[model samples]
Target: MATLTATILAGGEFSSPTDTPSGRLDTTGAFPFVGALEVSNSVSTYKGSAVAISSNWILTAGHNADLNDDGLPDTVWSGDFHLPGYGVFGIAETITHPDFSGFANPFINDDIALMRLASPLPTWSIFPSLGSAMTGDNITLVGFGRSGYGSYGYTSNATLTDRRFGQNVIDTLDLDDEGSGLAEVFRYDFDDPSTTGLPGGSLGNGTETIIAPGDSGGAALIQTVGGWKLVGINTFTEGYGGRFGDTGGGVLIAPYEDWIFTETGIPEPGVGCLLSVAFVLALWQRRRHCE
Candidate 1:
């Protein structure tokens, strides 16, 4: 078993070295759909984060499934996904994006993957009808990995079971900083709300944060009119450490929504209407009332 680090957040007040278990674990159960991923190969075990997008499907980083960088799933690697209050489930299969070129270059892009669970979860989270992400949009990041304060970056603490949530605004949609000719990726910086010298100029939501090593497959979700929609998948980070001023982002879900929906058998919001007739009727009524 391998213990992996998680995410780091701005401000020393948000985290402390003494905060055992993790810097911040979501005890409120606000994000039950987010979970922890542990995959083991013949050599070593790897850890990451994942999110339940459907009853039997999970979303994660491509590298999590193809740890050997062979552009295919490791033959000996077995995956276990742990959800809060839901216990652990075995991954039946994993499907990495066809464009993922492995982790040789940090900026290669197309780092998304889908995992099918052996058994369906009782519940899951919903995605936007049209997947899209924009600059200045605040996104909620959730992951189960290592933890530390922005003042010093990620620590050596091991807490793979704790899930933490934080917020940060999208600073750019262009992958220029990640190199040219790469697929689209949305980037966000870890901003210190008390300082204005950062790249995004102190755009922190107070709980601003940056992902650490084990948080590679975590989620970057944005709230929408319908509900919370997953906009990005945490893939890579560009910084000395998980400290202040660090920039991180992942593959934009919009461009791969078609592949995801088709592979996972999850219908687009307005396509097949997965929700029950009564539920749809209630949602329609609610929308009408708001209108």
Candidate 2:
């Protein structure tokens, strides 16, 4: 485990295991919903990250469905995603926010989308809800992204981590390019081990971790009275020259609760209980360290 933290403009890995820092651990137990998208029927063809909001519906970044500029997809991978164990799930539908433009100005307005699986998952998992996020709140990020930054930029498939979780604190809310206030986004500081006075990050091993390229559409989990609640989906990391500690935020889900419930047919948020560990949805538990 190497403690090298940098923004994955798009991924990273480490050298020897004893490099004086730390490495991201595999997220087999911590995140049950966290999974990768192997596009075009190939695991080696890392499309991006996706999380199961419901057994039959997955949540991911809107841009994952973007078409290639040349209009030829052979240059870029597309189509159904192949999940290990669970098999392939074709994209029955993709719904990005109507107001969403590409990753240009005001990217925070709406960068999320929901994908309905052609088939349902084997079991029902605890679905995350649209909740509030405030600055200084400690959150956990879980993704199937690479481990470190590479020569060109963030490393991809370098560590080949299936699921990686890290800790980070909310740094700011939404502010547009010109420093004007925006109503939709919440930002977090990307901690570089070199910097002093920053949150420990989502990875609790004292290692400063970040969302790599493959981490797109990952889960930003916040501690709640009822275990951990999924609040935001991994979206963009804004920084100059792909540096660490840049502003990374996503579409605040709380505001779109109505749209998410209506579109996905997951039923309106009425009663949600812990699915895996079998806890009451209203238990109001606290995470051990992130609190």
Candidate 3:
């Protein structure tokens, strides 16, 4: 319910992209986190957003799991994971922080969720790597969230921008009583004359890259160890100031690696699924040999 203003990149005006061809996970050369999260209740299925941080796990907002507005507990799901060019995979597991409550108070820190897969994905070409708590560095953001007054849906590719802040929650929202997280990353809008304290220049200017309906739990990457590193997971986003100018919030990932590892232990869901398949294959092999 809090609001802030962010500048929108004018038509025909946007950031320059890396000349390198975007890989398979890249959606429209923009934010690929838009269509990742898919929630299923008995009545119907709703699509949230998510990003594949590791081969077997995905990062997403915790609110996606809070099924009822009353905030008891929602059925968490990971089965909707899909690459732009790849088919959908069934999620074998869902995990969240043991301490996550459906409330927003501390502002930042506690809005991230991770899901384990039954098997690690062999490949996803265009996916961006994750990053950590270093500010001012540049990164890209893409989502199917609201772009402008008339814009919506997933992006085919991502837009690059300089990061303004690192590892902090910029905003928060309550979804049907369940709290959602928002990770703040700043990008400058060169087009806005008032960018430096201009009248409508609170939200950093660029293509409005905030998450809308389908973008949650997507990965936030930073350059580390020679490649883009996974740093944060999209948790919550809201239309701050006006609707166009807004910020996204997510959970910083590095701190949660241990929890993720411990919670998702070895012989992961993926391994189990693989083992089951193998058993079936072995049974078939024995039958054929006997025949």
Q: Tally clashing residue pairs in candidate 2.
A: 24
* Cα-based TM-score, every candidate: 0.80, 0.70, 0.58
lDDT tens digits, residue span 1-291, model 2: 111121233222332222111245542465666667645423334456777778788887665554321211233445564454456677677777655565443344566677788887777456565576777777777776555532234544522235666667777676433343544666675554444343344322244445666667778888777666777777766664333545566656665567778897664444543353345322445343346
Error of 1 at 194 (Å): 2.9
For model 2, the local distance difference test gives 0.57
Local accuracy by lDDT, each model: 0.72, 0.57, 0.44
Q: Order the candidate numbers by lDDT, best to worst.
A: 1, 2, 3
Error of 3 at 124 (Å): 6.6
Q: What are the RMSD figures for all models against the true structure?
A: 5.9, 8.8, 12.9
**lDDT computed for candidate 3:** 0.44
lDDT of 1: 0.72
Query: Residue 151, candidate 1: how far off, in angstroms?
Result: 1.0
Number of clashing pairs per prediction, in order: 4, 24, 43
Best by TM-score: 1
Residue 72 of model 3 has an lDDT of: 29
Per-residue error at 225 for model 3, in Å? 6.3
